[model samples]
Each structure stands twice: as C-alpha cells, then as structure tokens.
Target chain A: MDPKVVNDWRLRGQRYRLEGELCDHCGEAIFPPRDICPKCHEPAKTPQTLSGRGEVYTFSTIYSAPEGFEAYTPYTVALVKLEEGPIVTAQLTDVPPAEVQIGMPVEMVTRRLRTHGEEGTIVYGYKFRPASFWHASTQA
Target chain B: MSSQHLMQPERAVGIIGYGSYIPMYRLSSTEVARVWSGGGRGPIKEKAVAGLDEDTVTIAMEAARNAVARAEIQADALRAIWVGSESPPYAVKPASTLVAEALGATPYLLAADFEFACKAGSEALQAALGLVGSRMGDYAMAIGADTAQGRPGDDLEYTASSGGSAFVVGPADLAVATLLGSLSYATDTPDFWRRAYQHYPRHGGRFTGEPAYFHHTQSAASRLMEELGMDPDDFEFAIFHQPNVKFPSRAARRLGFTAEQIDTGLLSNLIGNTYAGASLTGLSAVLDVAKPGDRILLVSFGSGAGSDAFVWEVTERITSRQDKAPRVTDYIRRRTEIDYALYVRYRGKLKT
Candidate 1:
C-alpha cells in the first residue's frame, strides 16, 4: 500500500521523528530508555531524540490481510531492535518481501497506514531500511 | 445463632436496587449449530445475539438503568461504578464511565473495570462488598454483560449469550442481602483462553470440566461450607457459573448436592451462558423464588485463575422489595425471538 498519502496527515509539517530518551538525575542520552538512572530514584524522565536506526531482530510475511492492502497482501512486518533498546514493530517499507534478513540495518521512515476511502485522516508510523548513513561509525 | 456474634451491626450494603437486560432476541442452539455446521453434537441447541449497536457497553447501561430504577436511587448516589466483562468495547477507553454517564453517576465516582474471564462479575461483587463494608459508600454498582462471540465454525458460538445484571452493594437495613462469608482460590493454568482475538474464549474441549470448573468450584464451595458452617442440605437455592447447562448439574452431583438441590440452576439451558452475568443472573432467578432467611450459596470460576464461594442471607428487605426488580422468569420469558439470518446480523457475523 502507498504510504505517501496516508502518512501525509501525521507527518504534515515534520518529516523527522524524535525517537530518543531524555534523562532525569543528569541530562543524558540513553537508547532504549534505561529503567533507572543507575543512580537516583527521581523517577522524572523526559524523552530524548535520536536518529531512528536499528537492526532487524525478526520478520514475518503477512500472507493474509484485511481488505485495503489487497495489493500488499504478502507484505512484510518486522521488529527492528533500535540501538536505543526499544524494539519497534513496523511495516518493512522500501524493501521486497524476499530480501528481508535478520541483522539487516533499518531506519525510520514516516508512512501512512489505512484509508477511510474519502478525505479521512490516514494512520501514520515508522518504517525501516538498509543503512547508508554518511558516517560509518553510525552503525553502532 | 453462634455466627450472629461474628455479624456486626454494620450497615448491610445490599441491592437496594437490581436491574437486568436481555436483548429482546433469542436463537435456538439447534438453529445456530445447524446453520454454522451440518451436524455436530455441539453448543448443540441455542444462544442470545445482540444488535450491532449493542456491544457490552449498551447492554450494561440498559441493565444499569433498570437496576437504578429498581433501587430508586438517582444515578448521582452511585459512588463507584465497576464493570466486569471479558469483552470490553474498547481496549483503551473505560466502559464504566460511559455506563456512569447514562445512569447519571457522579463524574468523579470511582470508575473501574475487571476481567477474570467468566468470574469477573462475581469477583467484582466480592470486591464491592469489601469496599462498602469499609464505608467506601452507602452503595456501589457492579455490572456484568457480554456478547461473547466465537469463530464462525467454533463450538462456543452457541452458548455465548448476551445479557447484563447490576447489583447495588451497600449496608444492613438498606441491604437486600448480606454477604455472610466468602472463600476463593487462584491457580494459573490455561484451561481456556482466546489468543487470536477473532474468536470467543477457547477451552481445551472438556478440559475445563475436570481441571478448571469442577476442581475450582469444589475447592471454593468446600471452603465456604467450612467457613460458614453450612451443609449442602441447608441451602434453598445454589447457583453456579454455567459454561453449558450440563456443567452445574454435574458439579452438583460431585459435591453431593441432589438433582433437586441445584434446581434453580436449571434456567441456563434456556438462556445460554451469559458469561459474566451467567451465575449472577442465575442468582437473580433464585432470588425470585427465595424467602427471608433463605440462604443461597454461590460459586464462580474464571479460567486462567480461580473460583469464589459466597453465602448470602436473604433478609425481609429482599421480599418486601421483591416487586422492585423484575422477576427472573418474567425477564426470561419476555424475549424477542430472531431467525438465524437476523441472528447473524445482530451478531455482526454478516458482511455489510
């Protein structure tokens, strides 16, 4: 299914996603937000933004689907283990169903999900891809 | 008389009011089993189906309205509204709040939900009594309703009935029935569960019988007898959560309760398993014929966990206000019948 029109509403003004963690005791960057500061019990934690990039932990080919995505009936939906620790489930976009493999690099891409048939708001969410970051160390 | 010392002058929070809602519709099991599959000695002959707009929320609200009317208390008097059902309309939103609104309960009234599979409603009642016994409020409302649906060809399709019942829990003088004793136990084993969301809860065929239903029910009931100093012959009416009409009867035999001992439970064969409301609805039926000082022993089982055993003493308040709540048999007889096609339509099993 084409995500361009569907994701248009959710990503209307922002094409980028803020996907990292903001800390409590001392402002810090932590991937997959740490349960504790490993220091204090302040319990005050704010979200931090990071580049949405990860490796595929597992994937599945959805041979059966409900209506709308008749064209993408056999699409792949997978869990990409974010470097920040959160394992996010998303549609494996920009890739063929046959090519998916564990440990493949993926990055966040905003896309639309279902349709209301007319001018209804479309659902939006993250998708992954093979890494091509300008910096090599970004692999971490 | 010895137990009277244990009984305090505490206000008995009873159903100042009670109301029930069974969709004005019915479907014979024979029709459902015949239409879904050629012939399977299954959910064999009937069930209740709700209209598309009726889900758990509406059914619960309609019953709440009837109960509030019987109690004659404004919706505003409700200090807490708790709904127990496996089929909450939404995964995120609270159905209790919606019920509170329609019934005019105070907005801040504690609104919550509980799901212990089939036992959820009775469990809610136990908790509500504890809350009321502590003077949490003069009363609280607990409702159980379900339109439990099974997969197209699944056996559960037949007995998953739709209905709701509300009990107002409060103290002694205003109490219709007082909770005398309770016994319960929990064990985590899957005799039934619905992993695929597409179907109603599934059980391991009759695995629910030996392991889940009988074991838990016997455990709880025995505990009740021991705790309340009551014997099987001492009760006038006993209600058990009915998975099917045969279950309660079989369990009664195992517990040494005679066929006539559990005669009140004979009602489920006609209306099917109302899930959360199953046993309570049965209790409602028993109350229809019970007299003051009559003792009722009840037990409820919810798979993935436990059973609750409770004994209630029907007081003069129950009979004086018997006319207040609709008679159980009357409500059972006052249903609207539907054919297999409309049954599917009401069940949302048909395509738009």
Candidate 2:
C-alpha cells in the first residue's frame, strides 16, 4: 500500500483504547488528545492513555430520529461515569434496552455508529456493549 | 390524612406545587455544532449548556424555590429532599443538601441523589410521594437538574441544555399537583452509561434505538397503563423523558401517542436536554396549563435498569395559586447566540 495514498486508519485509536494528553501541570487529561495543557494554562503536556474500561453511571434510550441518525432511530444514549470521575455520554449497546441495568458492568468496544452519506468514510469510535461480549466475539 | 373522596384519583400524589430556574446567559446549538464540526452540522442549530462555574445543585435550588414560592405548604413540612441527575457536580458529597438549604427546607429531612439517565427526576418524584403518602414523611421535595454534554461532532452535543425543575409534595390544599397512581419496570443490561472517572462516555449507536429506549419506555409505560386499565388516550397531558427535540416525538408516535399529545415536547427541542431534568421539565411545561380537574401522567425511563411512572390529578389548589411558571418557551426562544468557537470553550473541548 502506498505510504500516504491508502488510508492507514487502524481498527482502533492510538491504542486498543483512547489516547489523551494530560497536563502534567494541571492534572487535566485531554482526550482525542492535545499537546498543551489547557487547564494548567501551560503549553506543556505529556501523552497518556486509558483502558476504555468503565461503568455506566447513568444513561437514556433515545427513541427518535435526528438528521444524520435516521437509520438508527431509537437508540440508547448513555452518560458513562469513567473510573476517572469524568462522565462521558455514548450510545449503549449489546444488552437490550429492556435489560439495561443501572450500575451494570460495561466495557469499551470499537463499533460503527454510521457512515457518512456524501463521503463514504466510516466514523468509528468507542461504544458500550454487554460485559459478556468483553472477550467473546461470536465471529467463531 | 388519607383522602377517599378525591375526585381525580389518577394523580393522588399530585405535584402540589412546582418551580424552575435558568441562568441569565445562554448558548445556542448552532454555536455548539460549529465548534466541534469544524464549522457546523449543515443547517444545524446550537443548544444551550451551562457554564463551568455553575453545577446541578445551583440550578436545582433555583427551581425548587419557585415550586415552593406559590405553594400552600411550608418548607418545614417537607420530610425528604431528592436531587435527580446524571451530571451531579460532586461525586462524593450529596447535592440534595445544597438544594435543600437553598430552598430553606428542614435539615432533618432525608436527602439523596437519584440516578437513572434522564428519568431520575420523575423517579425521584414518585419515590418522594411514596415517602410522604405512605406516612414515612409529611411532605417531600423532588428536584431534577443537569448540564448534559456530548462530544462536539456528536449529535447529542448540540441538543443538550442546562436547567432544572422542582416539585413540593404534601397533604395540603390544592396548589400542588396531586399524585394518584404509579407504576414502573426494568431490564438488567447496559443500554447507555459512563464510568465514574471518564471525561466522556461510550455508547452502542444502533442498539440504543427502539430496542433500548422505545421498547423499555413503551413496554414499562404500556404495562403501567395496562395495570391501571387505562389507554394511551386517557390523559390530557403526557410527559416523557426527553433526550433531544427529535427523540420524545418519535418515541411517542412509536408508542401510539399522537403529535398533539407529544407536541409539548417542544420544551426539550427549545431548551436542550437537561440530563435528569429533561422529561420532568416537559411535565413542568405541561403543568403550566393543567387545570385542577385535569389528569396527567408522568413517565421516566433510565437506561441500564428501567422506568418510574406516576399518574397525577391536577387540583383546585393549583388554580387558587397564581401561575408562576417561567414560560420555558420564552426562555428557549430567547437566544443570546454564540459562535462555534465560544461553545468549544464552554465545552472545554478545545483546550486553549
């Protein structure tokens, strides 16, 4: 494959997990990362990473169709409370909505939410699925 | 103190009174999308989010004050205070205390944070009514508030807003919306959620759809209605948990509710999703018009577990009391628009 010609985007981010730049000065971890420490008011930051492992602090099942989300009409959007105390919202997966339990164990998985209509580029990010699927991909 | 003669039995635990509050400043959805989308989400609009300085407690206090201001009961009458939210500012301490202190409610009252996605507030309300009506307490207060956020390019980022609503329940005259009947159901799995420390959470895009929200909400709601032996057409106003302007509408129709019935959801489309307060705020908007004799049903669904449903009957006390609801419509429409860059700063998405 041509070094730059072919899209080398991997199945995951910097690691099998998400990458972040933490301000050694401010103790703030920036995700999708950055070089400067915004909270510390410093232009210096170091690279750090996370396991993408966490629990579901809170969430909601969005039963609607927005502009881009038409194909996935009624989805469960969750506000995940990371081990770090920062709550991130994402789409909940695996366990059916009827079976989604609060404080239930969850882990991260690379999943496809949607692909751009105009551009064929597929947007991929971390999503929550049943913990049972943590190591069990039924691809067998 | 039990009432066997109550004319409207649906909302036996009626909201004897209600109140709300929003900060002076505003941030539109257009501004939010622009910052994250590198421009905008096409004709995308900006939704309002709260500033870093303010948190859930501050917003809840403001709303609780208004709910009690016009109520017939005294603050000392409340036996419990529950703060419902997903975006609780502090993880260790209790948020209900701050709200309780701001409302001047008794300190001896039981207080805790209610967690259940956007349905927390309604869930809290049902529980509070249980405490009071079941003789556990004489009166109780329930508050729902949040400053919900999502990644910039993410669809939820634009529609999430900040605000709160409060209800005071007691065995009093009629200023309060009465609670009549209540029901709930749940499924044990991960529909949506975040960890305790992550700055942002994860989700299952397609799986979250009808299977999670619609199925659970409709299933639980239908079960509640069926248990009550009532149909969807029974109530004048129906309030549901709101994730975005587009959400409740689609879910409502899917569950066999009509456009007119769910039109009140405009409150969410305009204001943004207030995490736990989303649907309760819609109900508060409905309470804006609900007459004493009118019947209302409040339903809340939290991902992860299940739902909490409470039926309310509007009371004459509501009529006797002057209308104090700050027109959410007015607040939603009044936009102090901001560019995408400013929104990025607010989201702290773009570090300086």
Task: Give TM-scores of the second chain, every candidate.
Answer: 0.92, 0.89
Question: How does model 1 do on interface RMSD, in angstroms?
Answer: 27.5
**Candidate 1 Cα misplacement greater than 4 A, ranges:** A1-140, B1-13, B40-45, B196-199
Task: Assess each prediction's global lDDT (C-alpha) against the native.
Answer: 0.70, 0.65
Against the hidden true structure, what lDDT does model 1 obtain?
0.70
Candidate 2: stretches off by over 4 Å: A1-140, B1-12, B24-26, B36-46, B172-175, B350-352
All candidates: DockQ: 0.01, 0.01
Question: Residue B235: error of model 1 in Å?
Answer: 0.6
Model 1 over residues A1-140: C-alpha lDDT tens digits? 55655655334222224334556676555544454554354453575555577899999989887776444456788988877666767777645689899998887644344445545433333456555421232223
What is the CAPRI rating of model 1's predicted complex? incorrect
C-alpha TM-score for every candidate? 0.68, 0.66
The most accurate candidate by lDDT is: 1
Scored against the true structure, residue B73 in model 2 reaches a CA lDDT of: 67
Tell how far residue B93 is off in model 1, in angstroms.
0.9
